[model samples]
Target: LGERVSWQTLATVLIGLLGVLVMLRPGAGLFDWAALLSLGSAFLYGLSQLMARKISDTESSTVMAFYQNGAYLTGALLVAGLFRLAGIEHAVHPSLEFLVRPWIWPALPDLLKMAACGFVASAGMILLSQAYRLAQANRVATFEYTGIIWSPLWGFLFFAEVPHSATVLGATLIIGAGLLAFRTERLRAAPPLLVPTGDTA
Candidate 1:
């Protein structure tokens, strides 16, 4: 665990965070408090990327995906069981309710829909595992910023939710940060120019 983040990398991250803050407008009284949870999730996801890279030499992507899904299923069931035992009948928040809801049998269509979600999740996990396996975690991780573009697009398509102007600005900064990271990483990885032993001119 001798990881050291350079100031340049830290600055790139801060720029990305600035973009998010611009979008969120936390000082404008419009920020959803739930985003704090997302910040925590981002930290954990970074740790997972490092762990995935560390283990990539010995494990196949499919194996990693399998275990990831298994752990998720186990953790979810444990949480649901504990919630049931605790007799928490109501969650004040919709998201919390989704998490602690009692399990029940569903119609075939509902079941199939849930199964499809599981399949997509497993495929996504496999792809993420492959990404970390094939690249430096720091460099590869920056690509996650590109995902910010999709959330707005999906909201527009599915929910008819129009993105605010700040969303556009934030998305631009986020994508720009990713591009800069890639360029920086590429430059750093390139061989240094050799000093001329003697000037031919």
Candidate 2:
């Protein structure tokens, strides 16, 4: 029980830190409130991931993804329903209907973009799970920091959003720290069950 609690707490802290970083980005109202909301999201997601890891050995990745996504979809629907019950027309209001409308039906190009995002995200998760099974969780989690390096290029190409130098520097530090910790943990562990490289040589 203590071990479980400790894992949950650590996950919460990492996620909370991520939230702080996200809220630092421009364009979210109530900087303080956004930070809080971001932290909450991070905490929940982190907890969910840790729980997923615990069960990964028992179930297939397809099963995990289905349940994980199902949970998220259910929560979203509940929220939407609550808002409707409260007589709120939408989560956020806009001056123009086009600006605020949900993209249930979009033009071809916009639909293509959404589809691409979904494909990339799903593929990334499959690869992530496979990596976790082969290596330690921390090691694969560290590689996720590479998104920081890639995000700027993606933004520049797709959205014309140039990243700040600070963002790059911060991301680099995070990636380095995560990788360093993971490598240290691996080193401390006993030798792999498989044959060593020297045996093959």
Candidate 3:
């Protein structure tokens, strides 16, 4: 099934993406390969949301989330094993270390924290899947920009970190873009005004 995106929606999407770039600020010396991975991940996520829309009528959100998490677990194990087999030194880089690090028994507290994280992730996946099930992909996707605002709030609350001016500005842009997209969608969905055939002279 093909869905056509309106020009307003496309413009707002571009604005939202621009805000993401501003927040990221990738440059020659400052760029990391991980940023590209993040971009690729976003693209894949959008694709997934679109695909979810097609199947949302037939498949339940719980089923979608189950398969999604199952894939994540399988991929993680496969990548970790491949990296370990390649004999990559853990000290090579933080990313490499993450991949090649040997599994160890964790303290009860650490295990609980990890479990909490998994719970939150699973809940989020279910909610997002349900959102796609209920609405157009573009409409749901635009609201993802709200994460820019939440990230800073979370960092401030949990890490005692203060956001820089650029972060604030970028977040503002993202929020604005989301609002614009919402307005565009609402206008598109609104019924056209009915005018009387006879006009007053």
Candidate 4:
């Protein structure tokens, strides 16, 4: 994996991470213990990508997606079981509450929405698994920063929320970094220029 990454790819990854930090703007007061959980999640995600790259040659993407979804389903069930058995008090914090909440049957409309969400998520995972199978992890990772551009667009379309200038600027940087990485990859892939060994007759 290390051997597969070039300096250009590393630079692009750093630039993409910089864009993420600029958007998040973590500060002294902004730091929260929950942020560590997010960081851990990101680390696991990167690890999974690395693992995908390692096995992609031998494993089918469908098989990868199947295992990934199975793991998620198992984890979700285990968490729900633990929450139920522990009988923990209702959490005041939204994140904690969501985690510990007991399962309940949703209304028909809500159930449909949940099903739709699951379908979309599963489809996305399958596509991502295929992408990892088809490309080097480092070469494709920078494109993940494109989420920064889509977030605000989705927010505006779905929730009528407008983004601040900082978001716009950060998205621009993220996109620029992705474009730079793609260009670098393209140039690297181009055939080397031929040099004449001797003067033509």
The candidate maximizing TM-score is: 4
lDDT of 4 at 32: 80
- What local lDDT does model 1 show for residue 152? 93
List the candidate 1 regions with Cα displacement exceeding 4 Å.
1-8, 30-36, 191-201
**RMSD after Cα superposition, model 2:** 6.8
Candidate 1 structure lDDT:
0.80
lDDT of 2 by residue, 94-152 (tens): 42233334437789999899899877877766666556555545445555555656767
Worst 10 residues of 3 by lDDT: 91-100
Tens digit per residue, CA lDDT, model 4, 1-201: 754777888888888888877777768355687778788988998898789878888998878888888988998889778777888759756566777666688999999999999898888888888888877887678988787678888999999999877677778778888988989978988999999899879
| Runs with alpha carbons beyond 4 Å of true place in candidate 4 | 195-198
RMSD of 1: 2.9
**Number of clashing residue pairs in every model?**
0, 0, 0, 0
> After best superposition, candidate 4 residue 124: deviation in angstroms?
1.4
Candidate 1, pairs of clashing residues: none
How does model 4 fare in lDDT? 0.82
Estimated TM-score for each candidate: 0.81, 0.65, 0.87, 0.90
- List model 1 lDDT by residue over 86-158, tens digit each: 8888886666577666678899999999999988889989999999888666656567766777889899999
User: Could you tell me which 10 consecutive residues in candidate 2 have the lowest summed lDDT?
Assistant: 1-10
In terms of lDDT, model 3 sits at: 0.82
